[model samples]
Target: MKMNPLKVIKNGVITENPILVQCIGLCPALATSTSAVNGMGMGIAAAAVLVGSNVVISAIRKFVPDEIRIPIFIVLIAGFVTVTQFLISGFFPELDKSLGIFIPLIVVNCVILARAEAFAFKNGALDSLFDGIGTGLGFTIALTALGAARELLGNGTIFDIKLTPAGFQPGLLAILPPGGFIALGIFMGAFRKYQERKAARQGKPEPVHAAGCAGCAMSGQCGAAAKGGGN
Candidate 1:
């Protein structure tokens, strides 16, 4: 089956952004997003894992057993995550130190694992690659934006550049973990509202990919509710 590459990429980056839409993988997003650079670093590492794991999983999907698929996916994702951490620690020691434990935590990030089970396991390698790229990019964009917003407010600068006056007093809370949550909530709400308005303008209901959701993490609950609605 031929897949529209643009559509697949757009789906991951926008229509179904893991952070803004699905709201998966928030731990690192909040922890490492105290600055734009940290957010970008974390995002890049996760993206690498996503692409590597998705391609391998899609390529081997046919040979894997249904019962043990999750374990197999984890093993593949772990391998990629290990490689990513090594590359970071060796090449960008500062970033590796900043990310620290969260770097390894990518192994269990719902975004990567969920994509493996939901899309990669069922799609062609090329399509899966694109999906991974899109998803990773989306995650990166969200985190970077959140980090930048927080850093700007807290430090009165963007990515370490002093954007405020010499005597400016930053909103100290914006640089803290609690500020991360506050920024995240605002971002999520704004994105959803924008999507809703766009849908309304197009004369379409809020978009919901029911078919895709059927294979997603929330599938069991969503599927049950769907069935109940039918009956």
Candidate 2:
């Protein structure tokens, strides 16, 4: 089947947003979103890793043993992450510092592994590239939005420029670790509500399962409730 680049991009940016919708790669999403610059840097680094890993995985899928596919994907992903980490450290020192350990931690990010296993392995190289781009863009958008919100509230700035009037005290909590969790939870709730409302407005059949909740690591908890009519 022919792949649609536009559709792939759109899926990553909104429909299957890795952070806001899929809730994958939450560690970097939370850790690096303290500032817009940091978030964007992390996003770009992750995008590079995702794209590189996807392309490599797609090209090698036929050669890899099924039993060892997971390990192979991890090695490929880790290699790309390592490359990105060094590039950032060598060139964008400030960003490297801002992103910190999160950059190296991308080696194990579920987003990369998920795409390699699910889409890249089965798709053509070009299609896998688009998928990676889409997923990366989605992740970037989510992180940027969250970062903007956090920075604006926590520091009274956007991208380090003052936004609020003079004498306004920033809300320190917004940039704190706990705030990341709170912000993400609120965004997820809002997204679910939006989906529900959109389905109702379109007269679409109510979804049998929650979006992105299926196949999740914690699905046993959510899925059990969903099956029991507790959702």
Q: What's the lDDT for candidate 1?
A: 0.89
Q: Which ten residues in a row have the lowest lDDT in candidate 2?
A: 208-217
Q: What's the TM-score of each model vs. the native?
A: 0.91, 0.90
**Which lDDT tens digits does candidate 1 get at residues 1-117?**
899999999999999898888888888899999999899999989999999999999999999999899889889999998899889999999999889999999998889988998
Instruction: Point to the candidate with the largest lDDT.
Output: 1
Considering only N, C-alpha and C atoms within 3 Å, which residue pairs clash in candidate 2?
12-138
Q: At residue 228, what lDDT does model 2 achieve?
A: 85
Count of steric clashes across candidates, in order:
0, 1
